[model samples]
Target: MKKEGCCLYYSRKSPMDDVPEEMTPIWSCTNEKCNGWMRDNFVLSVQPRCGQCDSLMEKSERLLPVLTNTSPNQKKN
Candidate 1:
């Protein structure tokens, strides 16, 4: 059996080698004790609250897969 988390299980290369990545907007919890965050585009609110900590959130960015909003209510611009 190949180790997974404890060890990297790769075929030829890392699975994320060819995937695209970008600086995506996200909301991070202000409470240092909590590791809570969510993608900014996933929520419609101007200022979103942390769902895990229920604390105020701040805008931030993360290197994540390029995603597009699929919400039917989302307006095209």
Candidate 2:
């Protein structure tokens, strides 16, 4: 049995460390009270509306994990 109170462990790396990220294009809702956002290239619309608030979304960019979207809906013919 390990002594719980006498433990002196220090982690060099946090379990919740942020993933590798990059500046990526996205669309964000214009609503001031909404936090709706989505990746620009992964959507099916030319200009997507906010799914949460049904509000207008504008072009934006954010630091996010580099992702490869393999969804057929996102493919451009």
- Candidate 1: tens digits of C-alpha lDDT, residues 7-38: 67668765786879999989899999999998
TM-score of 2: 0.71
**CA RMSD per model (angstroms):** 7.1, 4.4
In angstroms, the error of model 2 at 35 is 0.9
Stretches > 4 Å off in candidate 1:
1-14, 74-77
Model 2 lDDT tens row, 19-73:
6778999999999999999998887788789999999999989988789888767
Highest-scoring model, lDDT: 2
Residue 14 lDDT, candidate 2, scale 0-100: 48
Off by over 4 Å in 2: 1-18
